[model samples]
Target: MIKHIVMWNVKGDTPEDKADGALRLKTAFEGLMGKIPGLLRMEVGVDISRVDYACDVVLYSEFDSHESLAAYAQHAEHLRVREELGHLRIARHQVDYPVTSLPVCAAAEAA
Candidate 1:
């Protein structure tokens, strides 16, 4: 499986504006979950830190393979969401990695 993670910096001069923009983006990303193929799971997060360099929002998703992730990137529904979010975001960062499951150890062994 492939895990895709993305973080976005919202564009706004005021704190309220940035907060609202983040919520809007979070909602938009969450809405794309079931509509796209190969999208096994989707999650969105709003940053709560007071740090100056913190990102406004984040998206975490999983797919079956690289091909599935590529298709999702070009999917019309996703494109539409991206287009809508383009104006509200100032910067974006993304990373994709393959998920490798490790064997589960016995309870006593884990302890």
Candidate 2:
């Protein structure tokens, strides 16, 4: 499986506007499920920290494989979402990684 994660710093004229834009993006990303093949799961989060360095929104998605994730990147629906987001986002960060079953707490559990 492949895990794709992305974070964005949204742009707006005011904090309220930025908050609204973040909600719009969160809803749009969540709506992409089922429409796109290989998209096993999708989760969107909006930051409530109100901190200067906090990103406005984050997307966590899962795909069956690297090929599946690649297909999703080029999918028409996803492209449309990207186009919509282009206007609202000031900066973006993304990472894709292969999913593994190794337990992150294995050492702690052993102790």
Candidate 3:
């Protein structure tokens, strides 16, 4: 499996604005599930821990292979979301890796 992870840090005019913007971003990220194929699963959401994290949103997804994840990342809709929110985001981080094995905690559950 291929794992894709992304994080975003965004700021708005006000706290309420920040909240609204974050939700919109989440919606935009989740929209990919319907538009993209080869997706086994995907998730997008705000960081509830409220710790000293730079990103306000987190996206985690699994695909059958690296190519599919790359395609999904390059999809026009995905690019649109990136372009649309590029200005609102203060910072962004992305990581992709092959899943050789699930963590022990997750592996147990999978069984």
Cα lDDT computed for each candidate against the true fold: 0.92, 0.91, 0.84
Pairs of colliding residues, candidate 2: none
Q: State, as a TM-score between 0 and 1, how close model 1 is to the true structure.
A: 0.90
- Give the alpha carbon lDDT tens digit for every residue of 1-111 in model 3: 988888888788777777787898898888878778888888998876767655788888988998888898788988998899777788889898898987999999999
lDDT of 2 by residue, 64-111 (tens): 989999999899999999898789999999999996875579857876
Best by lDDT: 1
- Every model's TM-score: 0.90, 0.90, 0.85
Clash-forming residue pairs, model 3 = none
The order of the candidates by TM-score, greatest first, is 2, 1, 3
Q: Compare candidates 1 and 3 on TM-score and give the better one.
A: 1
Clash count of each predicted structure = 0, 0, 0
Regions of model 3 farther than 4 Å from truth:
106-111
Which regions in candidate 1 have their CA more than 4 angstroms from the true location? 103-111
Q: In terms of TM-score, how similar is model 3 to the real structure?
A: 0.85
lDDT of 1 by residue, 49-86 (tens): 95889888989999999999999999999999999889
Query: How much lDDT does candidate 3 score?
Result: 0.84
